[model samples]
Target chain A: MKDALLREIGKVVIPFIQIFGIYIILNGHLSPGGGFSGGTILGVSLIMHKLIEEPYKSRIKISERAVMQFTCVSLILYGLLKGYSFITGGGEFELLDIPLGIPGRILSGGMLLPLNVAVGIIVCFTIYTFYTLFDKGEI
Target chain B: MAAAANFPLLIILILFLSSFMMPVLKRVKAVKWLSLSSILLCVVLSVLTLAYVQQNGAFLYKVGHFEAPWGNELKIGYLEAIMSIMFTSIAALITWASFFSADYEIKEKNIMLYYTLCGMLLASLLGILYSNDIFNCFVFIELSSIAACGIVVVKDKKENIKAGVKYLILSSLGSGLVLMGIAFLYSITGNLNIGFIHQELVKVKDLYHNTLIISLGLFTVGLGVKSAMFPVHIWLPDAHTYAPSSSSALLSSLVLKAYILLYIKIIYRVFGIEIVKTLPILEIVLVMGAVGMIFGSILALLQKDLKRMIAYSSVAQIGYIFFGIGLGNILGLMAAIFHIISHALTKSALFLIAGNIIERIHSKEISRLKGIGIEMPITLGVFVVCALSMVGIPLFAGFNSKWNFALAIIDSNRILFIAVLVASSLLNALYYLPIIINAYFGEENTKDRVYMSKEKSLGALLPILILAFAIIYLGISSNGIIDLIAKSVSNL
Candidate 1:
């Protein structure tokens, strides 16, 4: 809110927060932290950035429509991906099998990586939108 | 033919996936068309599924790759197939009707959200109907509750929001109790699948008597509240009255029926009827249901608001369903299922008619509806048919259900409760007949009204007329449906 100290600290902190969020999303199948928690962390960083930079004219712009479209697209992709898996698995068809990679790798979990990424995008946008809507009543 | 087996799962997926597309689409008309067309597709799929079931018998479909004990499953039977058809078709009709009237009731921007909620709600309701696992049912129950509450508050009025909060809080409590019940069942049986749990429960029948009773009570009261059973139906009137008319129709006709269906599955599949009959729970249910029949109608008689009155009638009709279940006989349960069909048709038509009248007259007060028939002749004529059905007039759907209920009572050697049925019908008449009389006959009421002046277009009235025709058709040929229900009950 026009505070120089907080803005300086935020600039230093936000990048690390975002990188850690991405790491968790990438390693979701191999670790405890996954899409939801990682996405929440990223969302908090966004909220902090918005709070500190909202008073400045040069802040990064994120339109409400873009956030909504991103959320909806991610949700649709998530549904389609999961629905494909369910149909193929339930019907016992071996169609489009992405070979499972080494167990500890980021790509090891067939569809889990893509699903996690989609969920992460959705949760991130959703949380940021919630913040904006509550903060200003129009998101 | 093999692919037809997957229609149940496809119906759920189509609804959920298509609903997410609503907000992303720019055109409202496209969103509405998409919503209607998806529901129509489900209707066709459901009818195909039912036909497949009729030919092949009930089958269980595994969700994803997991087997029965480990993963989710959908048990599609005669009951489920029929229910899916009913839910999808009725929802399609309601969405079509609301297409004409939603702009008047809901804000332009919020209309897309309304369709989204309806889609989600129908999907979740179908989920509840098809789920073979107790925990799966619980998840669907929670989803349906939230979607139901969302549709209620989507009207964006202060009263709607207040009613929505009331409904949400009470419904959450209902869900919490259901979760606890599932926990109790899971702990004792070590399985979530209904068939597996039944096997385990039958083996250990005598070991955990008290726990069994507690879990049974929890399920009964929890689902009872969700379905608007007698004592716990307080939130229903406000929520239904304040919601948009299509939402009200869906709530009264479809949503409440799903929970009751789930309850029926629990009683029959999880805990067999022989085991349940030994407990005092069925007797309590029977008494409560009988009381609800009388009190719900009595309450309906006191409501001045037309929607509130119709909402209370739902409570009374639900009592009849529970009463049928409580009879704990084959015929009784069959009657309950049949009543579900009849009530779904009759009540949806009634609510949509109410919407038509409200749209044209800009009023919801029953007093203001006097001589409305003189203006909206066809709408009131449909209403008269629906009211007669509610009053159990011979050759209407309600009469057949009451007849079956009486036979079930006699079959169970509970002939005294037949009086409750008669009294409840009289009470139904007390509330419904006066409006019909004032609408059609009174001189002062009819003097100023122009015939056909307030009638909706033929396209708008077509759904209600079809529903009315279905009601009469059901009444005339209920034997076939009753036989089908009997087979389903035997399958249970």
Candidate 2:
């Protein structure tokens, strides 16, 4: 039955999926995974929630209103950093981090870890943003 | 501060995290104000980067201070600076306008997600702009494509979703080809920095002729797809047609141009002018550009849908940039860069105005645009000014750039090219000028201004006006912009 498919795709199973997403995000700088991969995983988990749960309840999980505001803020943060860099003369498009850690280690590279984390957030919220719109039958 | 030297990447990370937080903040009544403050702070920061670009010519920074021969590097230069300014300046303005529109278009539900994607889009764009190495560029490219896909598909309507799928597949193929080319270049040159690779290429040019040629061909193909060159333009019309207006502005204006900028870097900087001048490669690119100019414009003229027509027009305009590069003269190259700025101004301005019209009329078909101009005069006026610019009428951004392009072509003394330019400009008029005439002189519906939002839409309108005015301003004071472009292109 479709219900069984939904049951298997529930939060219990989805949490593990979300965790996997987290790992990919955190370890993005080291291996092939990065913000995009991790973020996509989070998006997939949200989809899992959609399959198993009632649409309305899951609506609150990733509110469309929130993604709008978040996407705006995320961009502004990039602007703010560059603006600050410009003011202080670090040069625009400058890279960051110690890369003190081993090449393959987590937290080892400069801003790659941070970059991955940012991408992960974007991926998850964007995916959820899509789901919210779709399930609302607004799409 | 050096303490925050990692600021470039941090910006994206913070934005990514904020996407997660944005949905939560929507619960708070004050969230709108909060978002405003944050974005303004960021915009101010983005504006600050121009000073840095002016001060530092260009350099690559290794993430974590890891030397680039071993680890990846973030390339910061004049080109990157220009791209950042373009991306952030327009992005901030649009997002600001979106803030006001969010009050209307977005329901109580979807506003935060919209903001999140906006940030993702910015970060991905910045990532693309800042990445020094080709592989790193690929990552950002994918990030941009994915985020863009999200924004376009956010509507989730069948048309929008279908557009997103097309965008994704075409973008992926483009990226795949670019990656393969990067691999090939790395194998021969053993380096990726444009200048450094130039050195390596010379040392090994004799031994690796086939590989070099193949890789160059691949890079051309890859970047061509992204640039939406004549043969590789299948995805652009749909992607541009289907996305929301702000999203369309970003896609048509910034995203496609960014890829083209990469092509400039790949051809001029990576391979060096010596090769471009000596080899027949410039001819290949030039020929493609000439065809794009004539072909894209002709296609644009036939479209009934305003957005689809505009999309096709972009395909044509991109050719102008390539034409400048193809001419391979200082004036020609300068003209190309100048045209890039002009087209960005004209195109994004038009798209924004189109957004206003779409909001009011609830349609993008050219036929439905009848008499709608009466109610939305300002929006229509902006569209007219921009269309004139596209047609390269005198005293607009398009005119100055076209003049430079003409001079460049004449200097090259290729009579066929002159014909191509003349023919294409006429073709450009064919598509764009008619739209303006139709809007102004067409049949009128009842003049009703119900639900018109121009006063509140000033945030969006101001940029269009500034750009349109600049078109005229740049046309009159063409020397300044031309000098800047000359300096920049010559440096490249």
Candidate 3:
């Protein structure tokens, strides 16, 4: 875990992993890959950094407070949007009156894309928090 | 504030929204009050919904504005409204009771999580009660199971964690079975909606008889485990006993009832009454219920821990509900429904009072409660009232339920069930009466122990007092409840 070679390799590989995850999240409705899959990748990248680097050497550490806040905010946003759609008697596909942009594009899914972003944030933050809680009995 | 049609979904929304916000709230006191007020609002909304349902008859609200047969829907009927009202009221009371005792029972850091779990658990139960789609019900079942486990483990004791893990494992298995059954039904009927599935199944009843029977069996075992039906009740005692007392009260009083109600809905709504009659599941349920009635009482009688004894007694009480359902008659179903309310009030009061007693005296053993009545007269007084009700004494809530159950089964050929009922009540008395007798009449108490505290905390005492009053009120107004449930059952 304290190997310099592994840490260097993780640093090189993490950016690609994050970019790929972001791609999957943004293009979720266009393809089969969605929020959960993308979020796992992002979460695994952060976990990888924790595993490879020495505790004091990691430059990009996510605080538990930040993770908790992010998870709560994202989930609350999702719930609110879902609740709005439900109360307005519209489908999940229609959060507001926004047009379903051009098909096969990154922004084509309307509420689904934002919802996917929220879900991805929740998944990523929850995964990170879950690891912290499991490793150290606090989060 | 909106149309009556929106209330069911609104209840679910309010619960989930508030629960999701609990972690963000810094002050545990604020979280507690927020949960209580929201749940109290749910109770008011549920009551209004009950009246709305009575006036408007059963109605379905399609979520996402989708068509009913294809999309998720919330079905509000007389039965669903009755269940919602029961759930919200009981939940409100439990949360209220927890406000006082939580400081003593739950650690400070975990208090917010505790309330959050309770809120999520109630929300999921409400979701289960109103959801018309089988898949939706399964999802809610999973959510509730997790919340239930969270509440158990929140105590942070080794045994609580063990019990929560055991509950999680067994409940997941139950959920797996339920999901499998839902899959089978969906495969055959191509619909997850209960009403649509019923229609499709009836049309092709003969074509898929074997698969249908298998699905029914899966449902029976699955729900049986979740509700802790007799043989599959291995997880109930420890899980219920080790949980924080308020959680235990909610678990024993309301959580199990929701599963049983869902089972009844599946049998009566999806399979139809005639099909269930043709199947042998009810007979199996009847026999298992009778055995559980006796077995659970025996187990209760053997328990050293008072909470564990009450926990075991729940199995026997659940048996009464199942036994009534197995009677397959309107009168029997009505009796079961009435018992749901009576048992909810009585058991919750008992658990709350038991929590108070343990907190006051630092004792969990039944033998140590000698002359406890002398110190905590009002608490023990409520305990006595609820205990007599549990024992089926005349002029009490349990008596009305037992009386109707007896009348329901008297004309039927299941004479053995009547014998089982009598035996169980006698068994109830055997275990319950001793505790009361020892608390009052036994001379094990010294003078110092007799004058500990005459006054109970307002928070701990109020819910118990209200529940005790509700028990007596229900007992005195038994006829009105019987008629209401009779109409509800007839409507079903």
Please give the ranking of all candidate structures by DockQ, highest first, separated by commas.
1, 3, 2
Best by TM-score: 1
Candidate 3 lDDT over B265-292, as tens digits, reads 8988989988888788888887788888
Assess chain B of each prediction and give its TM-score. Answer: 0.99, 0.90, 0.98
In the order shown, the candidates' DockQ scores are: 0.74, 0.11, 0.50
How does each model score on TM-score? 0.98, 0.78, 0.96
TM-score, second chain, candidate 1: 0.99
Screening candidate 3 with a backbone cut-off below 3 angstroms (N, C-alpha, C), the clashing residue pairs are none
State which candidate, 2 or 3, has the greater lDDT.
Answer: 3
Highest-scoring model, lDDT: 1
Stretches of candidate 2 above 4 Å error? A1-139, B1-24, B27-43, B100-110, B442-460
RMSD of 1: 1.2
- Runs in model 1 with CA error above 4 Å? none
Q: lDDT tens string, model 2, B37-123?
A: 445555555445545545655555655324566556666555555656666666666665555555444445555556666666677
